[model samples]
Target: MIKGKGYLKFSKSKNKIYVYLFGRLTGEEKKKNLFAFGRLENALENMYQIRESDRLPAELSELGFNFDDLDEWILALETRTTRNNKKINLPVIEERCFEDVTNYDLLGMSEKEVKSLNKDETFKMYSDLLEMIFGALAHIEELEEIEEG
Candidate 1:
């Protein structure tokens, strides 16, 4: 399995189903992939419009996310505050929270594995990965390391 800092895992156990967020891509990286990030941002913004909680899983499904699989663990939704400072909690299935991941590996796929996927599959894979990475990036503010002046 390709383990890295910038990945999300949505797993289902006999008793529970959940999503965990790992590391996030840097600002430069996000800029280079603006289209993907744009979709994610738009999605988040759109999510606020539908205030119903029960519809989230179905909504995620419509957006190419299948929560039934174990290995596909891929979302860590946070309650986002709007410009007016109103909190919007868009829950997926169960509890959603971010786990600290210190590594910087972007994709866990190998060359052969990536090559084997069809064009549509490849695009979906990238979209999903970017969605997760972008989601994490949008929620948290990255801190800069300050050296002694």
Candidate 2:
């Protein structure tokens, strides 16, 4: 599942915690699963806090979640909160045309030879570059948040 941003708001009037999950809800099953996982997290945390004074409950396995499932849930929570809520102002990513790279011989290859490569190769390279750029931006945002906090 792709990570999406979400917010948990405590509604005093309704006496309920309202969760706002920002993502595509394609089916009823998916929506139910998401809500269940969120509630499970809250319950687990509350139970652990009540049971243990300072230390964490012995490795979540004791708390009833299989280690693998716990890891997956933690990963999903992090992805949703960190990637979705964290905002970054990035420069417009420029899409390079075939002509743009023609001037430079990539890997010392001639312009003609480079141009002969399939469009897939060119697109793959661009995608990898953009991924790296976004990763760096995310890291920077995390660092700023840490410092501010």
By TM-score, how accurate is candidate 1? 0.25
Worst window of 10 by summed lDDT in candidate 1: 93-102
User: Pairs clashing in candidate 2?
Assistant: none
Per-residue lDDT of 6-82 in model 2, one digit per residue for the tens? 22222212222322223323332342223322332253344333333544335333334344444433433333333
Candidate 2 global lDDT: 0.40
**lDDT of candidate 1 at residue 92, scale 0 to 100:** 36
Off by over 4 Å in 1: 1-105, 142-149
Cα lDDT for residue 124, candidate 2:
58
Against the reference, the lDDT scores of all candidates come to 0.36, 0.40
After the best TM-score superposition of candidate 1, give how far the Cα of residue 131 lies from its true spot, in angstroms: 0.7
At residue 83, give the lDDT of candidate 1: 30
TM-score of each: 0.25, 0.29
lDDT of 2 at 119: 57
